[model samples]
Target chain A: MTVQLDFLKNVLYFSGLDLAEIESIDKLVFEKSAERGEMVLLEGESATDLYFVASGAVKVFKTSAEGKEQILSIVRPGESFNDVSIFDGGPNPASARAMGPVLLYGIKKNDIEAILRNHPRVVLNVINVLASRVRHLVSLVEDLSFKHVIGRVAKILFEQVGGGQMGRGPRLTQQEMAAMAGTAREVVGRSLKALEEEGAIKVDRNRIVITDKEALKRVMEVSS
Target chain B: MAEMPGIDREKCDGCGLCVIVCHCGALTMVDKSINIIETVECDWCTDCEAVCATGAISCPFEISIE
Candidate 1:
């Protein structure tokens, strides 16, 4: 119970809550474990809970009629997903799949609703989080429509490096990079090769090293 | 449909990303190649597939949750 309280404190929606409030919430949440590639929630299913990541990651994605997957967001530790579904009292907007062996803590919609009724401050924090999600979606659409394939690839690389917070990041497969970049895998491969040749990045073993930040930035925001 | 996860030998570049993320300890690196140590007990966390930069590991099945 104490451990759960610590984890809940890190969540953006509940971060500002006092110790007593967090303790109250700790009782409402339940634990779930999902293996990698397992679908945790299905699109169009009735939403029941909001999930927060404790460890590992989750990918919120949508599938077209033809079954092509477009990942909308990757929820990392200290973050949550399915907020829109739970709050709006609607079907899941997208399916959630575990990116790895993920441990999650979820609060039922009814439990969270009760908390929201009592805590107006939490509603404000939730609104801020939703607004940020909207901004991220807007940027995603803009990237898909306006950016060239190379630019998109560069953008993905930039983000993988903790948005310039880290000089290196896990080397992603071309297929994974293409999914994030919204381009063909071949295009992503070509882009990586180009970046490598230009000394903008170096793929050493299992990690990607940002060799030149300025060069990478230039490619990420390509005007053409 | 292939419900079981399988490693594509042609695609597996032996980067061992699969082994690193397998919380189940089912995958191991041998001779610079990935080998499934426990074929049946895989917790199916698909991290092996997600982390494989070469598209080598894949679980061609989706768990239906209702």
Candidate 2:
């Protein structure tokens, strides 16, 4: 088994495939690299390839007409992005950019179609990934419509703290948090301060802790 | 609570991403744990706290926005 196969084995869309199918994909995939903050795919560009992150992170985001940016997801290594365009034979729904220096493996759309024709498992996996993304979007819409900035901010922080675990969770940048909460960074900063005032969280130089999980959850429960 | 962000030695999980982002020389990882030197005052940029997932580093100051 080649290293590429091993990496493909772990991707969300490529998971559950046997070694043989993975070997074939290795032939069709091409390697690409991008510097930090470089554009990987642009919105409205006709779909040409399905990209998988081989290393580093990709930010999938949409821009408002007024030029405000809302990030949808951070596509990490062993994850795929821009599959919507590849699947539907349409332009990209969102633009993607490298969060840092990144390595990517992209399979052209025609080859992806060929693989789908050969492997039914790949088709099912794609369906599952799309379904999961839709469910996440639905939740985001509900939060945007019904939840205030404080609630959204508290919810992200509480979820990231890993519920009393000693030290487990990824580094989430404030900008990323703002994007996830569908608000501006200033709003999130204010929300954090408010959460601390409520005794739900503490942010000292020596320690940033979720002091009261219950309080945090209650704040999350509050609607806009 | 020090004026700038401080590291909770007990709560810190030793993910050095915070240390990497800290522009000030205030934070260091000593043996897989965050060590905040008392000598250097943090600039209070809050970048360290922004990257922390474990809530190990806190970057809060009193702000009145009434």
Candidate 3:
């Protein structure tokens, strides 16, 4: 149908395909939905399919035996996950959980392999995405190793602001910020308090306003 | 048994940042030094190792079977 083709056209991997190829690929795709907080994939599960996020968000994370969680990345709409696993036919490296109600498009490994064979350029795209993920992981490792808590918090805030001119950023809970910073909630609270004391930021009921962007950058620099 | 993370006492500044980052509660500070309290609870997520400011926590070397 035209609706399905339109959706396929928006996906980066299928963007190069013509109408006929899109339609053929669409036939091989299936839709899946998950409620908020639902587990979409489990770490160590066999990778049989690659998934595209049609709507909503999903958090990719690894869990400790004690039920502690370390989030790897968050997949937003139009992005995809499990490409590497599908290519290697290996188990999922991490688990994915729906942050909210989510809709996804899934393609089986065999179908994706066939498509890749026809369009080698798709391999380049996959590699590009994987490379970016590696870069992100490397930065995360660096942040965890070298950056202090305040520096990590500032970096995360700047990232959330999209590195644009500072203003009222997205509303996020303390717990959410803690998870992203790879620290405890208390640590985030203390850091935010310190930033607030320095007139660098303002914390107002689930939202943070960056009052002085330069001051925040100074905090990161001084710590680094 | 899985290899546990080893702490380099010489490098450890005892900042307790690793203790705060260790979600599994496997790490603790005693006498201004980091110690693995319960090895069984450690998931080797490398969270503590990643957050150590002094690179005090080193994960066990992993051998690739591939």
Candidate 4:
């Protein structure tokens, strides 16, 4: 198989597999593509395969009865998704939609199960992955419960841009931040302005650069 | 569609989308679940229900004004 070795070596899910083992997976995997705004997996539908983003982004979200899209997360390249439902053999709790033209490697659920059975180490790695996700979700819940909107926005910015000072901050628009935070765009704008006034961050066009990581971290730590 | 009166404790992921969408603060997350703090003054416009992808909120069978 002519699969990209770098992608295989770098992807967390496939990192453990050597060339031969990866080749076996390659045989079972096939490439798929989707246009922007297209649904990859619909909510309440059973997942048939596990997908890894080879390129582009996908948004995992659920729509309310009133039709508002609640974005769970925006998945980027090298991330694996659909595993939650695939492993449980239950219908997808949420849906995934392509954020743009997306390239993915899809492996049948049965093939992955077989791989895990034979490659016991892979199962352990999967457990670690799931545990890490659970930890992240728990943290998200805690943040939503106690942290104010500004803190949540700052924390999100920190996660996306890291601790380094950037000449130009994140390129995300306020609307995007609002969607991610499950809040309104105006609220995100107000929070960003407040952060800028404190010299904690600076807005450059669409981006917001963090002036001080330690201060922002402090803000995230402050309750209520 | 009639507005969902409130979330059943058994459901609701507490994702905060309902609170986010409600122009009114009728919906709030409590103990990782949604609670309708007030049902009156609820526009009954189904705005919160529109955003609940998990189907956690069910519409009130009958609307009663307080």
Best by DockQ: 2
Which regions of candidate 1 are displaced past 4 Å? A148-224, B1-66
lDDT of 1 by residue, A30-122 (tens): 999998879999999998999998877787888779675666876777788999989889999999998767889999999999989877778
Best by lDDT: 1
Q: State the TM-score, rounded to 2 decimals, of chain A in model 4.
A: 0.67
Instruction: Give me candidate 2's TM-score against the actual structure.
Output: 0.62
lDDT of 3 by residue, A1-224 (tens): 67657887878787667787788788889999997678999999987989998876677888778675666776766789887688777899999987656789999999998988877867777777888888877866665456587777877776667664533356444546667877654455557767778887775423466767788889988876
Which regions of candidate 2 deviate over 4 angstroms?
A: A150-224, B1-66
lDDT of all predictions, in order shown? Answer: 0.74, 0.73, 0.72, 0.68
The estimated TM-scores of all candidates read: 0.57, 0.62, 0.54, 0.54
> What is candidate 1's CAPRI-style docking category based on DockQ?
incorrect
Candidate 2 lDDT over residue span B2-37, tens digit each: 455667777787757666555566777889988777
Candidate 1 clashing pairs, residues 3+ apart or interchain: A35-B45, A36-B45, A36-B46, A173-B53
The best candidate by TM-score is 2
Model 2 chain A is weakest, by summed lDDT over 10 consecutive residues, at A164-173
Question: What tens digits encode model 1's per-residue C-alpha lDDT throughout B1-66?
Answer: 213357888899876656645766778888998887655556554556655556778653221111
Docking class of 4: incorrect
The DockQ assigned to candidate 1 is 0.04
